[model samples]
Target: MYTLKKSLGQHFLTDESICRRIVASLEAYPSRQLLEVGPGGGALTKYLLELRDIDFKAVEVDDDKVQYLKKTYPAIESRLIHQSFLDMAPPFEGPFTVVGNFPYNISTEIVFRIIEWRAQVQSTVGMFQKEVAQRLAATHGNKVYGVTSVLTQTYFDVEYLFDVPQGAFNPPPKVMSGVLRMTPRAAPLDVASERKLFVLVKTAFNQRRKTLRNAVKSLFSEEELQDDLFNRRAEQLSVAEFATLTFRMR
Candidate 1:
């Protein structure tokens, strides 16, 4: 048995039913190559191994958990990659699906990583802190909508699958967990420069309480800032609107 490390955000999912449902969600978006990030206690790993049609692999940063998982799920022994997901390349040369009960502390970074690999990751299903899940699934005008929502929705069709209770884990997290299913859009939203869009989105949200005119003044000319659209706050702009703004920025 491996001890949970607080630094790693390891709350091992212990509920059998929740485990089945997560794997079922992954099956809904079938893929030949799949990667499970942070297979903490192997709750979901148990079922993922049974998917004979897929080439499944698990990535674990913790050496103890990696050893534990390999011992517990001998079937995944050869396929397990001992690594922090933030550090690895796409598991396959071609397209793949990703799934996991992701570490909460680094969950935001994980989303960014997935976006960086958007061309290769066709779909993803995973558990995240409920608040983060909502942000990822939210559209403009939703209170929780912010940078993550804009960036993720720019590239994927985000679905808020379902919520999981704290009691579902061995050492429950303080907050409720929500599962999300993200599938790549047929065509990602257009942007003049991906870099500019990212910078603009982050800048706007950093001053979210201010109107875009006031918040993003530094990015635009006085005339551009004078546009009627700048009267709205960052949260008021849809992802497409943000993309349009990106092109207008200096």
Candidate 2:
């Protein structure tokens, strides 16, 4: 067994039931190709490999964990990638689904990376710190709703599937964990450009308590800020509103 590295945020999922639930969530969106991020100790990898008709791959940054997984499960030797999921390229040739119990430290970064590859990532089911998971699936008017909520919901339909408790892991985390699934939106919100929308959403949330006019003054003209929408705080605008506002940006 490999040691859990705190610096890498390695809290391996030890609960078989939660593992099956995560896998079941991914299976909801059928894809020929599937990628698992940070398969620390092959908890989910074992079940994923058992699925028929899937071209499966797992990206693991931890060298020791990779070796442990290979020695423990010989079937994944060829499919396991020894690289950070953030720095790696798309593992499959076409559309694929992603599943993982993400490292808590870089969980948000992983979500953004997946968003960058949204066109080819058909769907995703991942476990995250409960608060972060709520942020991903949050809608306008929810206090947790912010940049991640708006940006992610712009292209995918986010679902808060279920929650997992701290005791489920070998080294139980201090906080609760939750699982979420994301599937491509049949009709993604219209925006001037994804770049502009990202800029607007991130900037607007930089001072989330402030109204849009004060928070995003840099991106829009003084006159444009006079609109009624500018009176609302960042968390009050829906994903579609954020996308539409991008077109009016300077």
> Model 1, poorest ten-residue lDDT window?
185-194
Per-model TM-score, in order, reads 0.97, 0.96
Best by TM-score: 1
Error of 2 at 219 (Å): 2.1
Residue-level lDDT tens digits of model 1 in 1-250: 9998999998999999999999989878789999999998899898888898889899999999988997888999989999999999888989999999999999999999999999999899989999999999999999999998999998899999999999999798999999999999766688988899899999999999999988999999988988899999999999889988888999
lDDT of 2 by residue, 120-233 (tens): 999999999999999999989998898889888998999999999999997999999999999888887889998999899889999998998899999999999899999999
Q: Which stretches of candidate 2 lie over 4 Å from their true place?
A: none
